[model samples]
Target chain A: MEQILANGLYLGAQYALIALGLTLIFSLMNVLNFAHGQMYVFGGFVTYTVVAQLGLPFIVGLIASAVVLAVMGALIEKFLFRPVIRKSKRDESTMLLAAGIAFFLDAVILLLFGEKQRGVPKVVNGVFNWDMRLIMPYDRILIAALAVALIVGFILFMQYSRTGRAMRALAQDRVAAQLMGVDVDRYSMIGFALGAMLAGLVGGLLVTITGINLGMGGPTSVKAFLMIMIGGAGVISGAIAGGFILGMMESVGLTLLAAYGDVTYLVIFVTLMIFLAIRPQGLMGKPWG
Target chain B: MTDQTQTTPIVKGSAMSMNRVLGVGAFLLGVFVLVPVIINLTGRWDFYYTLTSVALLSVAAAGVWLTFYIGRINIGQGAYALTGGYVSAVLMTQYGVSFWLTLPLAGIFCALVSVLIGLPILRLRGVYFAMVTLVLTEVARLTALALPITNGAKGITSIPLPGELSILGLTIIPDFATLENPKLAFYLMAALLMVLTYLVLWRIVNSRLGHLCRSLQQNEELSASIGVNTAMLRVLSYAISSFFGGLAGAIFVAISQSIYPSSFVVQDSVNFMLYCFLGGLGYVFGPMLGTLLLYFGWDLLSVAKEYQLLIYSGALIALMLVLPNGILSLLDKKGGNK
Candidate 1:
């Protein structure tokens, strides 16, 4: 029972962290960024190279992965999305572009890394005992703690920082924000970079739990896409809430159902999506004023 | 100015183009039938199977392209294909139903399922609908895995070849077992089916129904205000789309002689959408061209081995960047693309 809680919280935290990136890009730019998962996988590759191959400290690898992917995200926004965005409908073309980028990155990774899974040894090994009743791994605790820290930090940054506020303003109203001199284009880049960075952070963290591979991007994108939809996309808080809820459910599923866990998780995920899609207001989302 | 306005009109093509389009469509489809036969004459039978698979795949992609015409992004067409494959497999293997008969039955089954689900799910607009569809193929895969009738993870294997197809007393297509290169028979069947399906699709798109669907793409609110029954139109297009997907999958199962959960996966769903997009969603026949190019393109890229995907995806991105409207757009008349 205690193990379930620990694992569940850890999973939820990771889901929240990864989903934060997806939701950020969607809300700010209205670009689905299907390649967001590729960015996450890329971050994992970078961290694996730094820590596993280069024998660097885990902290150094993590920071380096975040910075590198953040820049790549910005570049993608400027080059990939900007050119044809106005030519076609934003929803359709962005999806196609993102899928193209995703396939490209996946192939590149497949060429570079092959299909084998490579693990990054845990940063902090050994277990932590609390009152001799509850034992947990230190790295899992650290991961959970880091996820919370980052989510809070991101929220505060969005609330207080000038650029963050501009992002929020854009989400709230595009034309109004543009009228007030928030360079829509610049803010979009920041949003993509920030979103991609958060996904990279989770990717780096994921190396400790699961080995990274070339094909992780497609499934990761699907799961994250489902998470946002269940939480009623178009809002950050909803993404976080959906993440934790799904995280707990996934932990329970894996613990109880084992091999059939994925089916159960998706079944529950789809049910909630259908329900919320019908409602659209969702549990925590605004009533669509 | 008056001639231009009268010629183009506002909504669909002029009535006079119908016979011309029919003539061109018949000619192109005739080429599909002859091209493989011509290629096979050189002792290269593999191209026959490859092009056959292309036709089958484009049939499904055409369904997705239709949904796109109605301004809906459908990412789950694979679900219907998977379902349709299973439906054919079950009927033929379990009930002793003829394989040819299973084609329309599977299509009708899938079409009904789409309408049953489309009523509520179609209410959601844009990405929400797309995101939900993203789960659909996965859900179908899981159900196939868990369902006893689907025979679990092993999937239904060794599905018998379709019996000889006949009309009245005439045997048009011989049984699959009797053919020396069954791939040849499959190619002919797929090519003929592709031609017939394209005719139906062309008529639908060029007809009043096609105009209504295009109106939804341009402005749903305006179309609805004009009493177009936009919701009903969406549901209708969705049904037609899934029907084609089902027919294609049914044909696919007959060719492969087996059905597995993994056979039609989420990735295939993505590929289906890409085929339509890469073909030129604006044109009714874009999916056909797109599927052909993408199929052969991937085969050509196999030379690169490990670097194939990298080069292929890079090319895909470059193509989209250069021709957002797709390769067919290059041939479009500059000022009047339509």
Candidate 2:
């Protein structure tokens, strides 16, 4: 039971970190940004390049990736998404559009990078043993810690900061916020960039746990989608809840179906379908409005 | 300007063009029929099977085009194909059912599965629906892989050749068996089936149901408010599409004589959809063009697998960037102007 709890926390933190970016983008632009997973892949690859090839400090690689991807996100919104967005009838079309773009990018990346599992040197390697009966990696512990800190920081930023307030206002009502003197476009641009930046952060952290490759985007993006659906769209708190739920479920599933490694994905999808049917508005239904 | 505004002239011109189109279509059909004969004359009759493969893929792609007609991009259509293949293979391998009965049964079974899955998914909108279907396909695939009944990813093999049947005293036997040549059988069955499929689709497009599908794509709420029974129509379209997919799968298994999980992956779904989109989603001939173009490209670019992906991806991005409506749209516009 303790092992399950620990496993869930470690997995949950990773999921929550990834889902935060998805929720932010979904709320602000009402777009699912299917390519958000590609951004995570970008994060992993760039970090690998810096740490593995360039021999830079892992921390420096993380920071640099965040800056670079944030800019990329802003540019994607300005160019690809801006004009065609109105052509999209619903959030679904926007997601499809983004996914098409991601498919192109992923293929290009795979061509350049090749389909090989690559990883960065672990940050604070080694495992922590509790009474010799429980052993957990220190890196996962660091991930959980960092995830908690980021969640706290995200909450404070949304609650207290002026820019964050503008972001919230834009997410709640784009036209109303514009009428109220908020620069809706600027908020969206910033939100997209910041969301990407967070994804890059998670990407760097993820490489420490699991290897990175071009194929990671599809599975990662699906998990993030499931998280957003379960937690509710447009609510940061809901993202946290949704991520943890998915994370714990996945961890438990992996444990139970250890013989069938891929079975976890099926469990996650089945659980998500059931949960969404029951609470279409999501876990934090009131706050989603 | 006066001539342009005249409906009689435009209508007459369009009617004339329609006649030309039918003539051209018939010419193309004739060429398609003669492909095997021409290959046989060249002493490379084995190429006939490859052509049959293309025909089967085209039929499956055409089936998927039905769902696309309703403005829903279902990534789970491959699930139906996989299911159909597995059902036919299992029945043939385990229960020793005749291939003739198993063939049509596969289509019916797949249609039923499509309705079952489409029920929950139909309620989902946009990307959520697409993503959910993708996930569902994966789950279905994984379940198939795990089940011992499927040989657990080793895949079902040695599926019997479709048996002869006597319906209304026709005593139909597969052509290849009588000719003692596989290529002859392939060309006769696949080419004929494809021609029939195309005709069926053409009829559908000209029918009222096709107009309703287009209306559903344009605006769902407005169609519903107009008493279109939009949901039922969408479900019906989905079921019909799955039937085609299943039929294609059954034929696919019959030709290949094996069914495996690897043959039906998420990438297969993505590839078919890509073919549809690249061919031009709105055009009836889009899938055929897409299948021919994409398969030819796939053959040409087989050397550099990684670069092929990059180029394919680059081309897709460029296509969307340059021709949002797809390659067919350019021809369509040119045809319209002419």
Best by TM-score: 1
| lDDT (tens digit, per residue) of candidate 1 on A82-105 | 786766533587777889899888
In angstroms, how far off is B100's CA in candidate 1? 0.8
Tens-place lDDT per residue, model 2, A1-289, is 6788788888888888889998898888988777888889888887888888899998888888788789988987776666556543333434435757677668866766667898987889789999876779898898789878987898899889999999999988889999999987788888998898888888887887797987888778878877877777767988899899987887788888889656777677777777655565668744323
List, residue by residue over B68-117, the lDDT tens digit for candidate 1: 88888899999999999999999999999999889999999999999987
* RMSD score of candidate 2 (Å): 4.3
Model 2 segments more than 4 A misplaced: A86-97, A132-134, A158-170, A173-188, A233-235, A257-262, A284-289, B1-24, B27-31, B37-53, B163-184, B303-305, B331-338
Interface alpha-carbon RMSD, every candidate: 2.4, 3.4
Q: How many pairs of residues collide in model 2?
A: 2
lDDT of 2 by residue, B1-338 (tens): 01121123346777766775797678566647567568867987656766777777777788777788888877776777888888889888999988778878998999898788777667666555666666766776877887889887789888767777778879777434465776667666776777777778866865789889888888898999999998898888888888877877888888888988877777677666766766767677678777777776666676776677667656655555555555676765554532
By lDDT, who's the top model here? 1
Candidate 2, lDDT over the whole model: 0.76
Residue pairs with backbone atoms closer than 3 Å in model 1 (clashes)? none
Find the 10 residues in a row with the least total lDDT in model 2 chain B.
B1-10
